[model samples]
Target: MYRLLLQNALRPSLQKRRMKDIWVWNGMRMTEVDRIMLGLRQRIKQLDENVVILEKEDDRNLYGAISLRIIELELAEILALLDTLNRTTSNYHHLIIETTAQLQDMMDTMVALVKFDKMQVIKKEHENQQIKKDLEKCKNEQKATLPPPTLSPGHCGLGQMVNVSGPKTYSLTAYGTSYSFGAWGRDVNPAPGNDKYWLVVLSSSNVYGHYVRQYSTLSTLLLGLGPTDTYISSSNPTTNTIQGPNMVMYGNALYYNCYYTLSICRFNMTTRTVSTVALPKDAGYNSKFPFGILGKSYDYTDIDFATDESSLYVIYATTGNFGNVVITKVETSTTPVLGETWYTSLYKATATNTFMVCGVLYATRYIDKETEQIFYSFDTKTNEERYDLKIHIRKMQPNIEYLNYDPRDHLLYVYSDAYIVTYEVMFQ
Candidate 1:
């Protein structure tokens, strides 16, 4: 009889233990539900706030449109959840489980938001492409609307060159030939004691081929370009060589390079003689080790010279085991001679690229994990080392594939692969 009584008491205690275990499990679940529901409520509140803000603003730009879409999606989800809540009976345990499930749904919505941000990157790239196309159209239209010329300047096709006599604007002296390439005009004043004369580089393609003219503009008439004897002919079968000269004016001379050989040349306006400068010889070609000249390899394409009225500095790239871009200074004071030691790049030759802008030479080189962009200010007075801005990449467009700076307006123009852009740089 006593054993039976003890067994009954043990059964009740065991049952009570089982009830406690069930309560503990339910308590843990309720805690998880509370945290998850709180997170859901916060996210929904944020989304609602965003929807209100987006509704009030004008969505002319891209960000506004994206915000609007996100708001719409969030509202749709919230409405669906509200419908479920209204239909369902709200007992304590049931309410907890339902709220936890709703929290999971909000988490999924947040995941979708993250994915949308990633997709927006592609959208931004597309917008950049559209901007580039619009810019190209505007440029062509501007080219077409230039005033008609009054007189034929010479054999060269006169591009957009305007002559301002006092204040009244006059039509540019036209070119006799139908030339398609563009030309740029600059006032070239030779070193010490020469009058300021207009230097015009004109490019054109004809039945014969392509021709680039270097003309001296004293009056409206173009004094014969080049040596009055030597003429420029297109050697590259791939390109129309007369597609407007890529001429950069230093102090007194203009510098450019030929495509086939990577040879750079300079023309002294006073002497009227064109002379070639020696470039580092190619290490020779191998089937396994062929070199590719990236970007524009045409003459006057990828080279920039730093100079004043008296001296010229040539910077060009050559390829070997690595790529080599050599900076050699040439003193034109007596005989044209190489001065100072050459600057070997810290990185391998293939790892770096060089460009010059606004009397400064900028190099974009590959760093360990990042691309290192630095500029060297060439000083003529010291006749020595060029100063470098170490690892500096602010306020300058290092990703610019093509860069041109107008000193007159201090407007820096850069053309990347996707877009042509402009920046106003503050000089220190």
Candidate 2:
């Protein structure tokens, strides 16, 4: 018992002594490291400033290659010192304070370098800006020297209502002409299932809503419109009220929606017959609460599909009784049913809607009222909220009439009464 008491009594004193030694060693080492780091940081800041000045010289900057090598060597020494200090530090609390101070110094130095570099670039580009403005002015002056756009007889020919798909090259079903929008980028994939190219036009005639399909080829339409072998018009025009015929060309089959009943139909390119598939059920229409309305009960302003074109999403608004604007998505491969349907109820004073650039579904909610502005982003993935962006215009001077995202260009296309504008958006 005496021996046990003696061991216990000495343990605390021993531990305290060890701890004191550790603290002292850490303190001395930290003091030296701090001094070294502070001096190195000053050197780094000076070198960084020199780097910015040299960078302005462009080709002359390459002459400072030796100076850059020296700066890199100094930066390496600072990093090595930091690693050593980090390993030697006794506890995280003190280490954090010291590291934070060092990081702040580095950050401030970096920010200064960035600012100086940007200023130099701006100074260099100022001449370019002036030249561009002068060139535009000269072009405008030359506009008075030239004639207006000549209108040929069929310059704006109604080639028939066509849908375009694929890369930079767009396939015009009506003309059977695939043209590249830009000079360099172009790709082609024929509409799925149909070997013979066909022009499909959805006609909203007084008597009936029917789809017109005429067969042609890329060469035939581009060379000359050869005779159409088959013309498939809707046989049962009464029941199938097709509206907002945003036709999509999946592999070989063509698909479009009938808005009123909220049904999607697939047409075989060969047989050319319409059959209904399960999709979102259509909403009842009223008009007082919405900004705009489509003419037919089932016709909608916008319909979008996802990136893979595997999912169909549809949007339409009605306002007469202050009913909700509905948004729906249908997974193409899955059987369309109530169990498979996804929807959101957007109560409206006014709402203008559009899909995301990649067609990952989203709705920008906007309501203009007497007192304040309101907006929200409804994400379809989680059936929850993505609170990043909000659209409010009442408090602002200009009101937005339409919002659309261009998946092709990674641009947000906004249309207002006074101006058409584009904003860059990160396309993930």
Best by lDDT: 2
- The lDDT per prediction is 0.40, 0.41
* Cα-based TM-score, every candidate: 0.34, 0.35
> Candidate 2 on 188-269: residue-level lDDT in tens?
1234444453333334332123544333444553243663533335353545443443344443444445444545655554
For candidate 2, list the clashing residue pairs, or say none: 192-251, 192-252, 193-252, 260-298, 286-319, 286-320, 287-320, 288-319, 288-320, 289-319
lDDT of 1 by residue, 1-428 (tens): 32234336445533543453356456654454344344545656776567567656765765776876776576566555443432332344477699999999999999999999879988999999999996896465334423323222212132212211111111222343342212223323346653343322342231122333333442432333342222344353232122223334445554544433344555555564456655557521111122123442222333434432233566544455244445567655423455653544422223233433333344443333322334333322322333233332222223333333444433333332222334433332
Cα shift from native, residue 266, model 1 (Å): 1.9
Candidate 2: where are CA atoms >4 Å away? Answer: 1-202, 205-209, 212-241, 259-262, 277-282, 285-310, 316-322, 325-327, 333-339, 345-353, 356-359, 363-377, 384-428
Measured by C-alpha RMSD in angstroms, how accurate is candidate 2? 31.6
